[model samples]
Target: MTSPLLTRHGAVAGLGPDAGVPWHYGDPTAEQRALEQGRAVADQSHLGVVTVTGPDRLTWLDSLCTQQVAGLAPGESAELMILSPQGRIEHVAGLVDDGATAWLLTESAPALATFLDRMRFMLRVEVHDATEDWAAIGEAVSRPAADGEPVTWVDPWPGVTAGGTSYAADPTALATTVRPWRLVLVPRASLGAEIEARLESGWTLAGTWATEALRIAAHRPRAAFDVDDHSLPHELDWLRTAVHLHKGCYRGQETVAKVHNVGRPPRRLTMLHLDGSGHSLPEPGATVLGRDDAEVGRVTSVARHHELGPIALAILKRSVDPSTELTVPTDGGPVAAAQELIVNADGFSADRPPKPGPTMKGLLMGKGCAADGGDLPG
Candidate 1:
C-alpha cells in the first residue's frame, strides 16, 4: 500500500484506490506537461528541513557536511551531503542560512537526526526537527521566481531550487522568511492562511505516485529511493557541487577521494528509453540485459516520459563499455531499449571527451533546458 506520505496529496484520477508502493500509476503525461509548459505543483512536506544553530553552528556544520559550510553568509544557500563511514551517501541536502540560523532539508528527519547526533554529542550546536513546523509545495514552472521580498537564491546544483520560500524563527518580532521562486514549497500551517492568501493562484496539489513519476522523468534522484546506503556521489553525478574533495575530513572523505581519484565505481547510472513493451511495467530490481542478452543492470526508477515513451534509470557496471547496447532482462525476453543520456547527466569532467559530440544532458539536452520540460524551476 502507498503510505500516507506517498498518497497524502496525490491520487489516481480514474480509479478509487490509487497506485501501490513505488507509485506505479505515476502520471507521466501530466508530469511531462508540467515540465514542458505552464506549471505543476507537488507536495514535498514528507521531507524535513531542520535548523541547526548556536555559536558552534559554522564549525559544527563544516564538520558534519560534505560541502564546506564555514563561509556561508546569512540568506545564502549551498548544497551539501552527509556520508556513512564507508563513503556511501547518507543524504544530499540543501543548507540554508538566514545569517543567524542554518537549515538542512532531507527525506527523513529522524534519519538526519541520527547522523547529526553523532557529531552533536560534544559540539555546542542544537539540531531541531522542524519538518512538522513547516509545509512544502513543489512547483515546476517556466515562469520566473517571485518578485517581492529579498529572495535567498541557492544554486547548489544544476537544476535544483534552494529556498523558494525559506522560513526561520524570529528572536525579537514576527518576521517571515519567504520568497516566490522555482522550487519545492514548504508552507507553514501556523501561517497557512497568510500563505494561502499570498499565492491565491498558481498552485496544484500532487499525489505521491504522480510526484515520483515527475521526478524520474526529469532524471532527478530522491534521497532514499534514488539513493541508498551503497551509492557514491558520482553514481548519481553529485560530485564537486555537492561533495568537496579538498575540504577537511568528514565521515567518508577518504573513500570519496579514493573513488574520485581512481575514476571508478562499481556501477554507472544512466537513462534508458524503452518501448513500454506489452504495457509491462518493470519494477526496481527487474534485470537489465545487454544486446547479446547478457545481464547488465536493473531498473531503479521508471516513469513514462511525457514525450519520449517509457523512460527509466539504471546502474550498470562502468566496465560494460559504451558500445554495448542494453535491453531489459525480463521473463518474456529482453525488452529493447536505447541509451538515453539523461538531460542532467553531465559527462565526467576528468574522463569525458569533448562535446558538441555525445549529447549534452540535464537541461542542456534536446531543446536545451526546455527540451525535457521547460525552463521552469523545481
Candidate 2:
C-alpha cells in the first residue's frame, strides 16, 4: 500500500517484498539530519502490525516468546523474539499492550500471523493481521505515549533491563541517550492526515534510509536486515533487552541457557568504522577479512550517518580480535575498517568458575615462616 504522503512529497516509491513504502523523498542527507535532531517523522506504514485478542493474550504470548510479557502493563512497550527449537531466531516483534489487545509490530506481518496461528492449537487467543487497518509512524522521541493511551512501542535499545544482560562493557558508550526513537500506531485511513499535521507543525518527513542509518549508529539490530536463519540472541547482543535469562521455559530456552552458560556463541556482532575517503560504502553481505586477510565474517548492515560518516554492523567469528584491523570487499578492491566492539570476544561469561577462597589454615598462617622450618600451624 503506497502511502498517500507519497503523492505530496514526490517520494520515489520502493516496493519492499513485504510492503510498498517510500525509500526516500528527494534528499536523504537532510532527512537524516532532521531525524537525529528529533525534528522529523517517518512513514513506517510498510511495517506489519498484528493484534492478539482474548483474555489469555498476554500470558499466551509470554509463554512462547523470549521476553517476559505476561505482566506487561497497558501501553507498556517490550520486544520479543521467537526462536526455533534449536535456538535460532525465527521471528521478532515490538510489542505494545492496550487494556484489551496486544499489538505486535514486525517486519513481516503475514509470516508472523501464520506462525502464531500454527502455535494456537487449543489456546484462547485470537491473532489478526492488522496491517491493513493500522499503520506505524515513527519519530525520534524520548518516550512513548502516556499509559492507557494510544498504541505505541518505545524502543528499549542500548539499555539493560531487568532479567537481561549487556554485552557492552561500558554502558556510558550507549547511544540511546543521543538517538532515541519511538513508533506510534495510527489508523491506516488517518495516516495521510497525521503526516500532514506533523508537516504543518514544522516536522520534516524522513525515509527508511534516515532511520536505518541511525539504527546502525546506535548498534540496534533489525530483524529484516540483521538476522539470519542461524542467528541467536547472544550473537547480536540482543540479550541486552530482548531475552529474559530466568524466564519460564519457552521455545529455545534450553539452548539460550546452554550457550550463555557453558558455551559461547560461534559468532559475535561488531560495529565497523569504515574509511570513507574512498567515497564508497560496502554493501550488505560484503566479505569481512581479518588481519591475516582471511574471511572472518560478513557485513549485515551498512549506512552513512550524518555525523559518523560510513559505518556498518558485521557478524564476526568469536575468535576475531577486537583490536585487529579488518578489510571489507568493495568494488575498489577493499576498504580498511576498525572494529568497535559490540559483543565481547570472550562472549558472555555466565559459566565462569567462582574464585577460590582462602582456606582456614591459609588464613591463620603468618607471612613469615617458622624459624625452625616447621610447617605453619592450622
Highest TM-score, which number? Answer: 2
Tens digits of lDDT, candidate 1, 141-198: 3332343422233434333222111111111111221112234334455334433443
10 residues in a row with least lDDT, candidate 1: 165-174
| Tens digits of lDDT, candidate 2, 10-122 | 68775443246676789989999999999999999988899999998999999999999999998888989999998899989999898899999998789999999888878
- List lDDT for all candidates, in order: 0.56, 0.83
Question: How many clashing residue pairs appear in each of the predictions shown?
Answer: 13, 0
Model 2 TM-score relative to the real fold: 0.89
Off by over 4 Å in 2: 14-19, 147-149, 175-177, 349-378
Please provide the root mean square deviation of candidate 2 (C-alpha atoms, Å).
Answer: 8.9
